[model samples]
Every structure is written in C-alpha cells, then in structure tokens.
Target: MTVYALETSGLTKQFAGFTAVSDVGLRVRRHTIHGLIGPNGAGKSTCFNLLTKFLAPTRGTILYEGADISRAGPAEVARMGLARSFQISAVFPHLTALENVRAALQRRRGESFDFWRSDRILKRYDADARALMAEVGLTGWEETLAGEMPYGRKRALELATTLALAPKMLLLDEPLAGLGQEDVGRIAALIKRAAEGRTVLMVEHNLNVVASLCDVITVLTRGKILAEGDYAAVSANPAVQQAYLGEMAEPAHV
Candidate 1:
C-alpha cells in the first residue's frame, strides 16, 4: 500500500442544520498533484477549509502523513507543514514582492514585530526571499509592489510568499481562477514546477488544467464523492459527464 501524504476518512462538516460536506474520503499521494472539482456549492471549498483547519470538522478525521489532526486549529495545522494559499490573500499589496516573501519568512521564524528595527534584521531574510522569488519566476520584479504587478504575476507573488513557509503540502483554492489564456498557461507551468517534491491539492474549475496537470482527480457532487480516478477515467464516466461535463458541453442555441 502506498502511504498517502494526506488522507481523510468520513470527513464531514455541518452548518446549523445543513450539511456542507458529508462522509468524504480522500487520499492524496506524496509529491503528486491532485485535483478536487465540483459544481458550485459542491462543498469543495468547505473540504479545503476543513483540511486547512479554517473550519472545524463536525465529524470524522484528517490525517497528515498518518497523524490525526481532526481537531487541530489553522495555526496548528500550518505548523505541521500544511500550507494553504488564496484563502486570506497571502501577499501584502503595499509591500514589494521581495518584501512580502521576506515577511512570510519572518513569520515562519516566529520573529516578533519590531517597528523600531532597521533593515538589519530584515536584511537577513533578503537572500532567502530573493531565492524564493526567483523560484517562482519573479526574479526581476523584486522591487515592484505586489499590488502593482500584473494580475497573473501578483498570483505568482502570492505563491512565492506561501513557499516561504516551506510546506510539505499545499492547498490551493482555485489557483487558476482568473487569467487570460497566456497567464493560464504560465501559471499552469508554474504550478507544475512548484509541485516538485511536494503534495499539491487544488480546487479548480478549469477541467482542462485539471485534466492536463493532475495525476489524480476527485469529483464531488452534492457534498459527496462522485468519482475518483485519472483524467481519462473521470472524463469518460457517463455519470460525471451527465452531472457536470454535460452542462459544459451543451451548446448555446442559435
């Protein structure tokens, strides 16, 4: 049996009387890119929140590398090497790309905020931050404010900041949500490069990106698992096609 990097059994979440996620099981292999997809309101986001500990699970367990973390809070989970992106806007708009990554590194070290400090302490993070920025393909944009960057580059900056945390697994909620075709391709490549030697589980609506990039795809519908397989297998599933892809395939009337 292959040891999974992240696993969940009977994971569930309920808000008031409505169940957002119900009895879902997931097994994501180490160093692999996995895709979670569903129609709007399919509980994909809720599942992500639960995994990252943003929302406590009302029932079930979550295991990261075989350790149960069902009740762990967000900060606890993050300390355990699971990092989430795009949840709270990881990048600071006012800071330069390099500064944003430096800040994340500072936080990772549990460094206290010292408003009186000069660049001396901040300079120590510069080397590491610059390396991270280069890794995310933002080498020359170091001086540019994150907010001033192009839309796609800003997303890349956000990714660099997340990497400063040195996570074992990355939970990306819609990494490819907003972008033109060119940016889509660039970000896709960047994601593939970033997934090297780490586990990546993303919730994306772009089936093409998921189909092309993910090794395993899990389909969710109405708060339950509809299917789990490779892109080919899931795409060929008639039930999946009917429930999801069929809607995409329907032609607009002339």
Candidate 2:
C-alpha cells in the first residue's frame, strides 16, 4: 500500500461562530493524485487554504513527511515543498512567457532579478526557464507576451511557473474551473505530466477529471468528510448521494 506524503487529521476552520471547515481528515499518497469534491461552500477551498497556510486552522494537525506542519505560514510551507495553484490562473501579463518562468526560477534560486546584472549573465536562468517551459509544452511561445498568449497556453505557463518552484506536493485548487473541454484536456495532460514523481491533491468539481485522474477521492459536505475511497466506492456511498450526488447526478440518473 502507498504511504501518505501529506495528511491532515481533524482539520478545522472557524469564521466567528460559523465553522467553515470541520475536521477534514485527508491522506494524499506519495506520487498519486487525490481529489477533493463537494458543492460550493462545502469547505474544499478552506481546507486548501489551511494546507497552504493561508488560513490558520481552528483545530487539528497537518503532517508532511511524518512531521507536523499545521501552523507553518505560507512561505514556510512552500519552502517545505508544498505549493498551491489558484483557481484563477496567475501570471505576469507584461512579461514574456519565458520571462515569467525565469522570474519564478530566480525566486526559487534566491537570485536577485534586478537590472544590475548584465543581459549575458541571465542566460543560465533563461536556459533553466526555457527547459521548464518546454516541459510544459510552451517551447515556441517563450518570447510571446503572456497577455498575448491564448488562455490555455497562459495556464500552461502558470503550471510551469509553479513547477519551477520545485514543489514536492502540489495543492491544485480548481485547476479546470472556467476552461472549455479542449483547454481542460490540455491542462489536464499538463497536470498529469507534472505529477510524475510527486504528490498532488486538488479540489475539483469536474467528475470526469476526478474520475479519470485521481487515485483516491475525498468527498466533503457541510465542512466534513462525507466519504472517501476510490471513485466508485465514494460515489456509491449513501450520504454522498444525499448531500452531493443529488445535485451532481445526471438528470436521467436523478
């Protein structure tokens, strides 16, 4: 059996009196894709926020590589090799695709990105960035302005930037949100290629993507774990049917 690369036990988040997340226990195995699925307001994003250290958990613990990491800050957690991709794609619009990736590389390598350096000295960085861009299938678009690129290419660049951070476990938040079918497939392939040797946990609403890519599924409802297992097993659970599947099921199935 696969051991977990990341696990959260009894994770909780509260906003004033309302509990936004309630004891979300998660286990993401090493080198596997794990999916979190729930309706809007079901606390999927809050769980990601807690894991990414954007929100302080009101209760419980998070363990990474067998040590505690729940209270760590965002940058601290990132340094520990866990990074998040937002629901919305984020890139430097004014920069070329290559420049955007190089910036991320510079940040990761602790290099100053100031103009004090000669243009010739930046080639090493460019080489590194270009390799990552090509890995993400952005080879020829290196010189294109990020804002000028098509939407999917921009997102592919977004993943390349994240990949440049050298994360060990990636927390992807709604990576396919707002994308059409073709774009989704393209990005999905990028994500699959990205997960080759690391852990990936994502909050996803697309049942097809989750069913196709994830090795395990964690279903959330009302801020708690409703079900978890392989896709078929979780989808067959009665509580999931009541809380989530009713709305998510096809009309004929409903």
Candidate 3:
C-alpha cells in the first residue's frame, strides 16, 4: 500500500480567469497530522474544497488511499472514510447533542435518517453515539440542544458527530477559528486526541496549535507553496517569513 493517506498533483482551480490554486501538489502521510497555513486569500479554503470534492478542480488529480478520487462527489468520498468538518460549527440546531451524533451513526450504518421512527428503533445507536460524545468531552451535555450549547461545546459536538462516521481521514477547516484562549487549548487537545490512528489535514490560522500538533506544515502564499517542513524549519525560511509579513508572530510554546 501507499504511505500517503492523500495526495494531489498539479491541482489547479481557476475562477473566471483568475487562478486560485496553481500547480499545487500536496501529500499527507498515513496516521499523521498535517497542517496547511497561509495568509488570507492564499486559496487555503479553495484547495480544501477541491480536496473534499465540494468544488471541482479546473485541472488536476486527487488520490485518497492511492485511488483516484478527483471525479468523486462529496458524499462518495465521505462514505469512503474521508470526512470533513466545516469552518463554521455544523450541528443540527434543534437536536440534542446525543441525537445529533446518533444521526451521524445512522448515516454510517447506511440507514436513512428516519426522524419519524420510534425511539426503540433509534435506541440501537445510543451507546455508540454517547461514546463519541464522551470522546470529545461532551458527556454531560448529551441532553442539551446543540444550538443552546456554548460556542466551544458546539465545536466539540461537531467533532463528535464527525467521529461517529468512523472516518479514517479527517479534513478540518480552521478548527480553531473564533475560539477564546481557554477554548483554543481545549479544542487543540481534542484534535490531538482525534488524530490517533487517523490521518488529519487541518487548515488553521492559530500558529501555536499548528506548531505543537502538526508533524509537517505546508506554508502557502498567493495560492502557491512557499515552504514545507517542520514548524522550526518553515518558520526560519526567509520566503515564508516575508510572506507572512509579521503576521507570523512567534508562537507560544504549548
């Protein structure tokens, strides 16, 4: 088998004659956490969309587990054990945290979401759903409505639902965005735990979390790779430094 969990070659995306991602290649090793960081408008999100099949690439190839997935749809890729979380917390607002996770568990079992089904039919997923909730530190919030939960808790719940799919690879888009300092630390730790036995690809603006959690970091600027290495090596590169232009504050040690 392949050493890489995901790979892209000559990946390019253009919007109305403007190239957003140009001639990019990315490789993520198996069972490792890889971080993608760049300044605003660097096409990080666009690249992510292409990888997840939310947007079609203008030209390129994407391989997941050595199989060509460039032509696959989002749901197809997801069912193949590649799951993604959004920049915004995506939870069913009216559903309790446990129910939200149960919904995902149902999907994983290839069952249609029969909201009208009796509680007895749905109870089969409860144990697994609660386990996932506990995995993300939402044990006590199981009965709480997802929308009523605090922002940090909502993010945690989202992670729980994502985990219910039992994915082999996770694509997290800005997992630390809009978080307070305390919540940032908590969520970062959760992400670390989630990476166990799974490959993770994350796009985050939080430099400290990236430095501590990522096994490899790829720096992009103006939609192209500027440098790729460990945090120390990438941080020391003059080109990467110039690209950030002081936005790359010295990350605090975790």
Candidate 4:
C-alpha cells in the first residue's frame, strides 16, 4: 500500500481566467491527522472539493492509495473508502439519531429501502448504527430527534452517519466552525480516537485545534501551499504568520 493516504502534485484550479488554487501540492501520510489551515477564501474548501470529486482540477494529479481519484465522481471516490463532512452540518433533522444512522448503514449495505423488512432484518442495521452512535457519544441520544440535538451533538450525529460508510480516509471541513468550547473538545477527542490507522485531512481556521490534532500541517494561501511541516516548523514559518495576520503563535518571516 502507498505510505501516503493522499498526494497531489501541481494541482490547480481556475475560474474564468482567475486562478483560485495554483500549483498546490500536499502529501498526507497514512494513519495520521493532517491539517490544512488558511484564511477565508484561501482555496481551502476548493482544494477539498477537488479531493472529494465535487470539482475538477484544471491541472495536476491526485493519488489516493497510489490510484488517481481526481477525475472520479463523488460516489466512486466514496466507495474507494473516502468520506467527507461538509462545513455546514449534513444530517437528517426529522429522524431520530438511530434512524438517521440506520439510513446511512442501509445505504452502505446496498439493501433496498424495504420499510417492510421484518423487524428482525432491520434490527441488524439498528445494532450497527447504535454502535456508531455510541462511538460518537450519542449512546444515550439514540432515540432523540436529530433536529432536537444541540449544534455540537448534531455534528457528532453527522460524523456517526459517515462512520456508517466504514471509511478509511476522512476529509473534514471546518469541523469546529459553530461549536462551543465543550462541544469542540468532545468532537476533537472523538475524531482523534477514531483516527487510529485512518487518514484524516482537515481544513481548520483555528490554528490551536490544528496544532494539537495534526501530525503534519500544510499552510495554504491564495490557492497554493506556502509551507508544510510539523507544528513547530510550520508555525515558525514567516509566510504562514504573514498569511494568518500574526494571530498564530510564531512570528512571520520578513
């Protein structure tokens, strides 16, 4: 197997002659949490879209497990063991947490939505979804309406839903955007725990969160990578400091 979970070379994207992401490159090693941090409009989301097959790259190649997945459609990419979370919450608001997760498990199992399936057959899915709910700290909330959950827990539910897909790689976009401190802590821990032997790539505005969770950090600006290294080195880069307006721990290079 390829040592890196994801590798991109000379990746670029353009919109009507405007370069949105240019000559970006990255290498995310297998079984580690990798952070992609940048300011708003820095092409963080755009890069993610290209990775997940939501957008086509204007140039370059994307290799996942040594296979080119850049041109693959979203479903095809997902079936290759890649799953993603949107910057906005994606969930079933009306269903109970259990039902929501069951839906995802059902989709992954390739079973018809036979609402008439004997309760016995459905129980098998329920059993699977419950385990995911428990893993995400929704063990007690399994029966709660997903719409009734708080913002953070709802995000957890979203994670659980994706977990139903049994992904080997995860792409999380702004996972902490609207979370409270407590909820952020919970979800961060969950992500870290679930990361065992799986590749996690995240785009975060909060450098603190990224610094703590990421084994490697890639700094992006104006659609290209400015620097990439461990926290200490990347944080010390003058270019990254300049891009984040010196809000980060290290000073920018002059």
Candidate closest to the true structure, highest lDDT: 3
Error of 2 at 54 (Å): 0.5
Worst ten-residue run, lDDT, model 3?
245-254
lDDT (Cα, tens digit) per residue for candidate 4, span 1-254: 77999999999999999999998888999999999988778889889999888999999999999999878899998888999999888997888899889988987887766666787877788888989999999989988998999999999999998888899999998988899878877888888988987899998876777878899988888998888888889888877788878777563331
Clashes of each: 0, 0, 0, 2
Candidate 1 residue lDDT tens string, 125-161: 9999999988888999999998898988988888988
Task: State the TM-score for model 1.
Answer: 0.94
lDDT of 3: 0.93
| Candidate 1 residue pairs in backbone clash | none
Residue 133, candidate 1: C-alpha displacement in angstroms: 0.9
lDDT of 3 by residue, 101-181 (tens): 999999999999998899999998999998898899988898999999999999999999999999999999999999888
Off by over 4 Å in 4: 112-118, 250-254
Candidate 3 clashing pairs? none
Q: Candidate 2 has what TM-score?
A: 0.94
List RMSD in Å for every model shown. 3.2, 2.5, 0.9, 2.7
Model 2, range 135-252, lDDT digits (tens) per residue?
Answer: 9899999999999998888889999999999999999989988888889888888899999998999998888788888889898888998888987787777787778647544321
